[model samples]
Target: MTMTEARPATPLWRRPWMFPLGLLVAAFLAFSLPPYLGLDPARSRIPAPTGWYYPVLVAHIGFATVAMVTCALQIWPWLRQKHPTVHRRTGRVYVFAGAIPASVAGFAIALAAPFGPVGAVSNVFLAVLWFGCTVQGFRTARARRFGEHRRWMVRSFALCMSIISNRIWGVVWAIVLTPQLDTTFGGSEAALGQAIAGITTWTGWVLPLLVAEWWLGRSRGRRRAPSPA
Candidate 1:
């Protein structure tokens, strides 16, 4: 092919893990959301304090789900590069209908989180970070600083996806620590469970954010590297 010839696009199947990861996310939501959709407080997976807690929790979940779905689309390279209009539209939905509401509701519920003090602090910090990154991303985009906008949005998306890691970490911790309850917590299962939950809550999001930062730094370095002659 001549220099002017357009290169053939890579097949979607050969693309990186995003598509398969997206499918896993979809599967998770499908399995996890049904119980909450019924809107009965009794069906809630988390223990609720009655009245306002359940309603706010439901609202948070709903909006976070919206953010989760749109963030995936927004970060999709094919859609962003080939269909800029769709990307922008979905970005608006992600900001207005998703991140804002979800983070606000998350902040509210985090104050009364049933998972104990460490989990509460983790949730609160996560909510604030999510909100801050999202708003900053929007601001950068508005200022036509596309590079900064992409970076900020990537951070926001990392926070959004951290919940999945949180669950995965929770399950792993539960499995490992359940057998140690008698020895470690004086036979108190509740104490052991709380300990695992708190530690995983921090590890879940913090670890993912650290990984995201490392990736961002690596990419930035690559961009700045001198091209081979």
Candidate 2:
């Protein structure tokens, strides 16, 4: 069969859980992420922010926070299908107000973040992808290439969701590595923090994007698979 003609159906087990789980996670992120954004880096576990840290951090989080909340609202299939206008408008906000400003400011914060060079690099990558994907999505939508727009937007949000994934990875890391923490970091909180930051940095957005790519590839492959006579 030709590509686009041999598409496969999703499994029943996969149908119900994804949406609810996403909403639950989104809710958790909404509730949990804000306090850290405005936090004085010195007062928080985050590396101490340096000169102009407060304003830059605020701008980054301000946009990112809106994106996060709106992203969750837009995730529902019903809203997209039934309220295209809403989707379009919110999507515009998510791109312009949320992802773009947040990413740029995040770049600055990352440079100043004490998580070390690895953390700095990871955050930089996140900032780049976040802005790039959102812009791509916006362009595609404007060009009326909706399928590509959907793909890009999905990719965009996967990056946006990194903040949540980072912490989740941290929790898992802590639990799994508690015994070896001192050995790994030589009893230095700075060393340990850097290690955790580095791991989470990659795992956060990288894993999600990898999964999205895999899913996208599988979908395309199934569509291209030959049909039996």
User: 1-229, model 2: which lDDT tens digit per residue?
Assistant: 0012223544535458557757766687577666675565554445455768766776777788888877765555555655667877788788788888899999888888877899889989989888898899888888888778778877887888778888789888766666676797677877777777788788888999998888878887998999999
Error of 1 at 204 (Å): 1.3
Inter-residue clash pairs, candidate 2? 1-226, 1-227
lDDT, model 1, position 92 = 89
Strongest candidate by lDDT: 1
TM-score of every model? 0.93, 0.83
Residue-by-residue lDDT tens digits, candidate 1, 1-229: 0011234534566668778769978987998799899899888998896569999999999999999999988887666766677888899899999999999999999889778888889989999999999999998888878888888898998999999999899999999999998898899977887788899989889998998899999999999999999
Q: Clash number for every model? A: 0, 2
